[model samples]
Target: MDNIAGSKSSLTWAVHISVALLVALWLFPTVGLFVSSFRTADQIATSGWWSSLSEQESQNPFIRVSGDQVQEGDLYVIEGQLFPETDAEVSAWGTSSREPEAYEPGAVVDLGDGQSLMVNEAGAFRMTSETDMEGTRLPRVFTTATTPPEFTLENYEQVLGGGNGTDSMAQAFISTLTVTIPATVIPIVVAAFAAYALAWMDFPGRALLVAFVVGLLVVPLQLALIPLLKLHLGIGIGKGYLGVWLAHTGFGLPLAIYLLRNYMVGLPRDIIENARVDGATEFQIFTKIILPLSFPALASFAIFQFLWTWNDLLVAKVFLIDATGQTTVMTAKIIELLGTRGGNWEILATAAFVSIIVPLIVFFAMQKYLVRGLLAGSVK
Candidate 1:
C-alpha cells in the first residue's frame, strides 16, 4: 500500500511539473511578442511596452501672457509658462527666428521698450510693463512632448494586408495549405493502399519492399532535396504547387506506409479470413474490413503528415522556388519577414499563432485516434 501510494505521488508530481514547465515555456515568448507587437516603434525603442499602463511625466511647452497678471492684495501672479515640467527635450527654438531662447529660463531680461520679463523653469513668466502695455503680445513658446510609450495593432494590420513585410504570410498561408493538404492527403491515399497490400497480400518481394521503405525512413530529407528538385525540373514539372505536393508525398510516404502496415498487420487474422470467405474481394476487404479497422492508424499518420508538411520550409523552398513568386509557403514568407521586418513583433506573433492554430486543432481533434491507433491490433 505504501509503495503504491508513493508511486502515485511521484506520478502526480511529475505531471504537475511537466504541465507547469510546458505552460511557462510556451507562454514566455508568445506573451512578450504579443505585448511588444501592440507597442509603437518609438515606445518599443524607448522602453518595454509592458510599461504602457504606468504613469509618466514629460515637459510641455506653452506660452504665457505676462501682462495678464494683476496686483491683488500686494501679490504678483502669472498663470502660464512656456514649458511643462517633466522629461522632454527642446529641439528647436525661435525668438523672431533669430534669437531663440536668447535669455534662458529664470532670467530677467529687458525687451528694450520699458518692458522687462522674468522666465522661470516651470515656464511661468512675469512681466512688469511700464504702463500696462496693452495690445502687446508675448512670444510663442514651443516644446516637445516626450510621450512615455504606447501600443497598437497597426503592425498586425499591415502584415495581414501584406504591406509591412517582405512577402505577406497570409497569402503564403493559403499557398502552404494548397501544398500541404494535398501533400498530406496523397501520401495517406497511396500509403494506405500499399500498407493494405503489404499487410494482407501474399507476394514474393513484399518483405523486401517493406524493409526498403523502413530503410528509406532513415534517409535525411536534406540529402534528397537537390536530386528531387532536379527530378522535378527534368520531368518538365518545374517548381509549382504540384511539385511541392509530390515532393512532400514522396518524402512522407515511407513512414506513413510503415506505420500503417505495422498497425494493419496486427489486426486479427480471423476477421480478414472471414471477410475473404464471405466472397469479399481483396479490394472490398481492404475498403470495408481493413479500412474501418485501420482508422486509428490512418488518423495517426494523417496528423503526423499534416504537421510535417505544414511546418516544412526547406522542401517548400526547393520545390516551389519559382520565378513568379506564386509558390511561396508560410514558413518561407515568415523567413522573409524575419529578414525584412525583424522588429515587427505583431507580424511575428500573429504569424506564429496563425501557423500553430491548425496543428493544434489537428492534434486535439485526432488525439483520441492517436492513442487508439497506437494500440490497434496490439491488443488482439
Candidate 2:
C-alpha cells in the first residue's frame, strides 16, 4: 500500500507543519526588522515591532516644562504642550518621578507656593504662579500617553549618510559592492572553465583533483585565513580590493568548482561529442555550448558566492582593511556603528536591512536555479 504510485506519505502533514514553522521563524524577524527600519527610536523602545500598526500607550520620559509667560489676573501663566506636534493624548501625568501617573489628564494640582499646574488630555500643560516665574527652574512632567503609529524615512537618511555628512555607511556600501561583485564574478569565471575541463576532457590526475575539490568543501574557512593573508602580504597583494577579491575567490572556488563539475557531469554527453565531431574547438564548445547549457549551475554558484562575499567580515578584515580605513565593507561598517550608534536601534535596523537587500535580491532572483543545480547528478 505504501509503495503504490502517487500514494501519500503518513508524515506529509508533519513535514508541512515543520516547513511552516521554519518559514515563520525566518519571516517574522525579517518583517520586524524591515518595519523597525522606518520607526522612530522611541517607538522601537516602547513597543514590539508587531505592535507598531496600532495606537500605542506608553510612559514618556520626563519632559522639562518651558514656555513664555502671560499675565492673567494676578497670576503669571506659562502654557505649553508636553509632546511635539502630534496626535498624542495624555491619559495621566505626574509632577514627581515616583508618581508618574498619579494624576489624570485635565486635573489641576496645588503646588502650595500660591502656584498651580494643569495638564490636559491633549498633552497641553499650564502653570500659574502669583509671582513671576521667569528665570526660575520649572517642574518636570511625566506623562502616560497614547500615540498613533509613526514611521519615518529619516532613519534611512542617517544610515545612508543623507541626514548627517559624517556617516560612512554610504561609502561602505559602495566599497562592499566593489568587493562583492568582482569576487562573485571572478570565481564563477574561473570555476566554469575548471568544471568543464574536469567534466569533459581527459586529463592527468583529474579524479584526484575532483576529490580534492570535494574535500575542500568541508575545510574550515578560518584555518586558511592566516596562511592566505601571510602569502598575500609576501606576494605584495597587500590589503585592498584586489586582495579581498582574491581572498573571496579562493574561499569560494572549491564549492564553485565542485558544484559546476557535478552539474556539468550530468549534462547530456552526446551534445559535447556531437559538437566536437562538428569541428568545434574546446574553447568554442565551452564558451558557446557548455556555458549556456550550464547556466543553472553557474547561477547557483553565483548566488552562494555573492552572499558569502557580501556578508564576509573576517576575510575582509584580515586581507583588506588597513589603518587608513579606506576599504571598509558593509559588515565592518555595521560593527563600527555598533560601537558608536549602538543605542540608536532605528539607525542600526536601517543599516542592517540595507546590507541584506542586495543578497535578498540575488537569492530570490536565482533561487529557482539553486535547488535544481544542487540536485544535479544526484540520481546518477
TM-score of each: 0.69, 0.89
Per-residue lDDT over 1-380 for candidate 1, one digit per residue giving the tens place of the 0 to 100 score: 34675588878788899999999998876677667667655556555555666633333334445446675444434445454433333433233434554556566666566656665555455666555455667555433333434457676666667664464667777898898788888899899999999988998999999879878988999998888888888989988888888889989898888889998999999999998888999989988888888887888888778888999999988888676776777788778768876876556766766677787788788888766655642323
Q: How much is 184 displaced in model 1, in angstroms?
A: 0.9
Indicate the worst ten consecutive residues by lDDT in candidate 2: 371-380
Among these predictions, the greatest TM-score belongs to 2
Q: After superposition, how far is residue 42 of candidate 1 from its true place, in Å?
A: 4.1
Error of 2 at 307 (Å): 1.1
Tell me the whole-model lDDT of each prediction, alpha carbons only: 0.72, 0.88
RMSD (Å) of each candidate, 1 decimal:
8.3, 3.2
Clash-forming residue pairs, model 1: 38-151, 38-152, 60-84, 81-123, 82-123
TM-score of 2: 0.89
Distance from true location, Cα of 202 in model 2, Å? 1.4
Worst 10 residues of 1 by lDDT: 85-94
lDDT per residue as tens, model 2, 1-380: 54666545756667889999999998998899999999999999999999999999999999998999999989899998888667899999999999999998899998778888999999889999999998988888999999999999988888786556445488888999999899999999999999999999998999999888888887888998889888888999888888888888888898889889988898999999999999999999999999999888888888778788899999999889999998888899889889988887898899999999988887788878766756752434
Give the Å error, residue 111, model 1.
Answer: 14
